[model samples]
Target: MYIKRSIFSDSFIRLLAVFLGGAIGSLARAAIVIPLAINPLISVFLCNITGSVLYIFAARICGKNLKLVKDFAATGFCGGLTTFSTVCKDGAVSIQDGEFLLSFAIFALNLLFCVASIHIIDSLADKFGKASK
Candidate 1:
């Protein structure tokens, strides 16, 4: 006997995975970031840079077959943990507060750090993966 599951069942399960992971990630972010809100830029920077590193590591570790883990950790958690909206809002706030240098610095730092973290983590993962096999 063959049993068939509906398409929506898989999607629903994936969505649930993402939702749970996102919730946890958001909470983790709030715990770290809110305390550091004395300097909003620092909070955003940490979230973004850490999230990029985490996503890269998670993707490398999980590989292609673990769709649930990849979606949960990389897509959902990292997406929730690292926020584009908050970064934009922080930049806007800085501009409104007339901290032009800080604003530009924030933008530049986020861009540079996130890019560098991804590249570095990816390279390390590749090296480690080959050595492991």
Candidate 2:
């Protein structure tokens, strides 16, 4: 006997969810980054911070059973919105330009803010969750 696989298989659906979410997230990032006259590093930093906060919010809101939401929001959207490669490139470029302090500051601040935003959002979500119950 031969088995036929449906087009909307679980894995396929999950992949589609991620792909759609990523496309939207990437477009959103570009929309923000492309128009700003500010430093490229600053734009990327803002995106990273925003993405971190969004990921935490999604994780808390989605909970354990909402795998699609988690995958789309936290994994796909956040991953697309935040550009670690750009951050690394910025740091490298700064270093090459002999701006050692600037490179260090960019790396340090990004790390600090992203981690802090995650904790702050998670804490706020916990508090709100308790208050709502």
- Give all TM-scores, in the order shown: 0.87, 0.89
lDDT (Cα, tens digit) per residue for candidate 1, span 16-132 = 999988998899889887776467668778889889999998888889989999999999899889988888888899899999998898888999989998998888878887999
In model 2, what lDDT does residue 58 have?
A: 86
CA-lDDT, candidates in order? 0.87, 0.89
**Residue runs of model 2 more than 4 Å from their true location after superposition:** 1-8, 130-133
Query: Using alpha carbons, what is the TM-score of model 1?
Result: 0.87
Off by over 4 Å in 1: 1-4, 131-133
Q: Please give, for residues 1-133, the per-residue lDDT of candidate 2 as tens digits.
A: 1233564587788998899889888998998899999887889999999999998888888889899989999889998999889989999999999999999999999999999989988888788889999
Best by TM-score: 2
Residue pairs clashing in model 1 are none
The superposed Cα distance between candidate 1 and the true structure at residue 133, in angstroms, equals 5.0
**What total of clashing residue pairs does each candidate reach?**
0, 0
TM-score of structure candidate 2? 0.89
Worst 10 residues of 2 by lDDT: 1-10
